[model samples]
Target: MPRQDDAGSESEHGKIPKSTFEIYRAEGDSQFRNKSFLKAIECYTQALEIKPGDQYCLVNRSKCYLNEGNIAKALADAEESLKEDAAFHKGIFQKAEVLYFKGDFENALVFYHRGHKLRPEMEEFRLGIQKAEEAINNSVGDPSVIKLRSDGDLSFFYAAEEKKKPAARSSYQKPKKEDSGPKRAQRNKAPADSKTIKKMLGDLYADREYLEKLLREESAKARKTEHSEKIQDLCIEGLNYLDSRSEFWQQQKPLYSRKKSAMREAAEKDKSSAAKYVIATLEEIDNKQTAGEHEAAIKQATRLLRTVEKWSPEDLQNREEIRANLHSLIGNSQFELERYDQALASHQADQKIGEEHELEESQARSRDNIGRVLAKQGNFSEAIQVWEQRLESSKSLSPMESTWLHHEISRCYLELKEFNKAKELAEKALSYANQMGDNQWLLNTNVLVAQCEVRLKNYASAAGNFDSALEHARIVDNALAIDAINRAIQDVNQKLVEEEKRLEEERQAGEQGEGDAKPDEAAGGEEQQQQQQQQQEQQEPVQQQQQE
Candidate 1:
């Protein structure tokens, strides 16, 4: 089995990032070279999941399936590999090879011819054609006589009826001479001597003048000088070079060509084995968090974050986005654990990345998370600011999300004793809830609105809103909420009664005070009249004195 640790690194944070697809595919190739077909299939399957419809992965997987003797699966993969491009030469060769292995020599031959027509430079197709023909000849005797015209041209369509019968032989004895000269063809078969060797070397290496001269000198030295062993060694070296070249073109180059094309496209998307693995690991962290394994999730996310920080620009397409998400994951896990300070830092980091990159969605998420963390820590003022900023800055927020944000903001305002602001936001939240038609949100928002009203001393309105909330709670079948709303309604009704009594007492006090003020006014007028009469008398005396 392949090393699981290498498949997913836990702590190699400073290494150059390799693509997930490249890593897995390269591993698959290694396994294939080792004849580990099952392991190779696993690796290729992973590569395919990351990059669907990859020609190299599909064809290589087909080859693995073929090695496993899974003819059906092998053929299916081979056929699917060609679906994108029928002229994919590797796919053609693989399909033809599979058919030939499955004993369908006729179809194999057809595909081989097709491949040959498409890519004449490919030696595999030529070899396939020859094998398929041999298989056909072995399976069914060649009834039609074929005439070899020059070197390779053949008269393959000659009718069986055209085959001529041998003519009747007439016996005529002739005397044979003893030890007659060897036939010209017999001498041609002998190993070449010095002069003949020179001529053969000249003709053989004509295209390579350098090799011709080298071989000529070597051959001369081998025959006439003491460097015979050197010439022999050189001959062996040449044979080995030819074998290696033939093997490379026949076995390796075709696969390399297929991979080159796939890698070109994968590069454009910044996809690789390591990148895909990182994505998968991120999903795993999400699952762990969802499953309530907060500690484990935090640990995994921390390690992955370290690794991600070392990633090259070419390693992953959304490097910054992935980094922000990792921060979010860690923050969320910390929040779940009630580690408010650590959660705040992580969320702040996430927000910083979002703002720097201008990622709207990331910014929205970070703000929401940070707000929740702050709210949990009793920092309602800052939490409210964060949520309101999200509401103002984000246009892509869903109606449900908007309702939640408004509702949260109202709660924060209510916490700060800002009744009017709380009431306004609560009403806004209620409208959004109505639009979404969510009974739970409706119940929650109505209760919130009622609380704001109560804080504002609107007892009657609070009672009415509580009744509305109670109805919604009933619709949602929330038993706890039903009991709570009933108690709240009772409290509001009591407050209303108290409010009415207070209003009545104030009214009576005003009426009595008005009556008393009228009496005082009458007495004061009488006193003023008396004072005016005395003043008139005094004034008359003063006027008489003044006239004397």
Candidate 2:
């Protein structure tokens, strides 16, 4: 075995001491533990090169790719591992995990079931099956009632092999010693037993029926656990992911429909084919924005604004919304460039269009943009006022949006040294985040609350809140957040020590001052008594002389 210290090292020959596959695998494992996923992938790749078709290295590399957000490569490696041995439990599980993350619950469930059959003792496979089932149900009601593949394959439970074996040759053609092995015998009997197949199908049908019934019940909606709702959201996310994965979905739907409608109307009026040019120009502007070419985006948006202004209301029914959006886009690009004054002017114009059109959604969005620009300009009081107005009228705001509003307002309060108000708003933001089940927002609100506590001199509470924020940050795998939280924890601890030391010094000074004052008071009383006796003696002598 390679020692931990030997990871990523080489001998005089520019190779590990043993130069064996295990050495490379061990180094990969070490790098994985350190969360250096890219480096781990490099090490695992080298290991696989040394030991081609090694199941362990392939699966490990797939996991590294998954962690690095390369789901396609991860799935490829996972399937490759399975090609080496279809019955490999780890490979099956890895493939299921990748599919699950990719939002392919049906395929994922099949692999999960396969892994469970191969390794009945593994709880992960069971959990995977349950999660995939829930996701499937959430997206489409009871699976049993849903149409299965036209072929005999029940893909949800057991995926058919992509390639089928050739039919058996005439009985006398293939008599050989190699064909007499147990593996060969198993392959010969690959089809499930009739009774077993029937039983599995019955179970799947029953599961589907139960899901259909549950979905039909009015009480079912009320009874859905928070986890189920989260699964439903995941289902929607998977759909969106699939849509984005396809080129037509990415390009044809959102932009083309509205642009084409307006362009058709405009072309009919002008008898010209300027629609394509306008569409291409708009796409170029968007591309520039996405590429972080803020200046170019702003210039393009300004030119587009002039063209849009020339279009009459007859050409575009939603002309105001379009013009407002262009202004908003320019504002956003300006904001990105830290041109707060120009951004503010653009967003104000967007708000004006919203007011003229009575578009509440656009108005709310414009107010938000304006507030953000104001905040960036250090006009936090103005920002807070704008955000508060926006919040008051936002009946349709999502929990995430509500959380943002509360959190940003609290941040403004914190900057103004209004600790109590800041803490109150932060707590409200936390509640909203909890309702949304958003760990990223949870992390943000928790940190905001901790900051409020720190400003209020609640160091202990701040420390506790910071610790909670750190846990949220870790769950989200935000390295920057984790590092910032760690530093915040350190700062809170330091403040706590300083506070204790300051209080102790003040207490000791108070005690010393009291002790000195007691002695001075007693000596002053003795001096007063002595002065009285001397005055009385002098008065008696004068009285006696007058009597004589």
Candidate 3:
């Protein structure tokens, strides 16, 4: 989770010195290597503070941001670096990559040409050119169109402890030729078997090559003879095959294009055919459940339940895309019917299926949905915990996904009576929603912000957020958002009016008490004066009686 302190920007007091570029770099690279991207962002931010256009850090750091699923930061850094040096191949390539990732394919293609022109003979740069060209041909060429959680940390995707097979039980023994010995893909990395290896030597070297090719510059420093030999070998072995066949490559393009076209057509047919029958059933159940006949919905759900139960992994993967939709329908129906156990049970069963799957993306989504169900039951803390875990595991979460996380976090903060944190997270969620252009999420975040204000005793602000929520609700055409906002607005207005009336009544009571006290003091003074007058009158009466 990003620290609450990162709410705005760096603090003025504890400012990192402007000269500490090395420290900033250390922190940035450490976090980048560890895949702790939010920290890396902070580090890069500090570095940029010291030196605005640190080209090396800016370019490398921007790529890290992209890997961290921060498209805006990546775009900003890439654009800024490119501005510094328009023909700088590294920065230009980074810009093109960011553009491609952001779905700016036409502009990305144009930049790709510019980048390629700067380093036409470079292999990696040519690959970027190839990627752009392919995007134009595919009509779906946005390379930057990353799905949420698409990037798996190398450590996560490739497990560290390989489970030994039964045949390979002997410890300290090398593998036999029959097993082909783990693909040998991480090999061919030795630098002539002479130089002591740096920890990130391979990956660093690769990145530097990528940088030089895209930057249209020579290597940063002259390499060791051994290193030169290795690079030369790679140049020969990697792109040399393409070079060897370059003469005839254009002739093969037509055949390749025909095969690709046929494959795409077949894929579309397969995709269309793979939808589940459960979708229609889910709709029918939803209507039935709405009509207060939840048993009918449950019966409808059972149609797919048994089929899903009997499905193999392949079947589930290919044909059970509607499982979530159908399950949600049934769960809603059961809840409306006052069958809490059944509703919870249905959701739990679906959660189990998600747990059974090994796909991290699917698993994160499952956890998020489970947290939603828990939230409906007012288990806000538990829901936040579930999503916090999911968010932590989720690599490369986009802005929309982050909105979901922050919105959920705000709800949990509300339940915990952390009103300030709740409001902050709600506001953060709104910002992310705007970034994602997801109106529904924006509406939800606005409504939550209103509720947070209510918790903070800020009635006027609550009313304002409620109005904002209603506006967004109208834009999104969300009945629930509209209803919730209207209710909150009315509630807040009534509360404010009542509070005003109560304060007026209290003021009037206080005035009446003061008036009563003054009269009491006057009455005491008058009684004493009257007593003195009576005494004097008695004395005078006695004197007059005496005179008479």
* TM-scores vs. true structure, each candidate: 0.49, 0.49, 0.35
lDDT digits (tens) for residues 1-548 of candidate 1: 33445554446565432347888899899999987999999988888777877889889999898767566567778777877688889998998887776655667777888899999997667767765664443221121211112221111112112122232121111335873632211101111122222222334334334543565566665355536545544554443333222222222111112122222234346557777777678768865653345788899999998998898767666778778878978997787667899999999998999899986656877898899889878899999989989888987765667877898788787768788998899899999878877665677678778777777788788778878987876765545456656766766777788889999999999999999999899999999999999999989988999999
lDDT by residue for model 2 over 1-548, one digit each (tens)?
Answer: 34466555766777543456887899899999887999999888877767777889889998888767566668778887877478989988998887776656667778888899889998677767765665543231222221112221111112223333233232213457777632210101111122222222333434434433443452357677756655544443333333222321111112112123342344345533344555566677765654345677889889988987998866554567668778888987787666789999999998999899887656877898888888778888999999999988877776757887898788777667687998999999999978866565676678778777776778899889889988877765545456656766777788788889999999999999999999999999999999999999999989999999
- Model 3 lDDT, full chain set: 0.57
Q: Is candidate 1 or candidate 3 better by TM-score?
A: 1
Question: Candidate 1: which stretches are off by over 4 Å?
Answer: 1-272, 533-548
In model 3, what lDDT does residue 96 have?
75
Candidate 1 weakest lDDT stretch, 10 residues: 183-192
Q: How far is candidate 2 from the true structure (C-alpha RMSD, Å)?
A: 21.4
Clashes by residue pair, model 1: 19-272, 19-273, 19-274, 20-272, 20-273, 20-274, 20-275, 21-272, 21-273, 22-273
Q: Which stretches of candidate 3 lie over 4 Å from their true place?
A: 1-294, 311-329, 336-338, 360-362, 437-443, 458-548
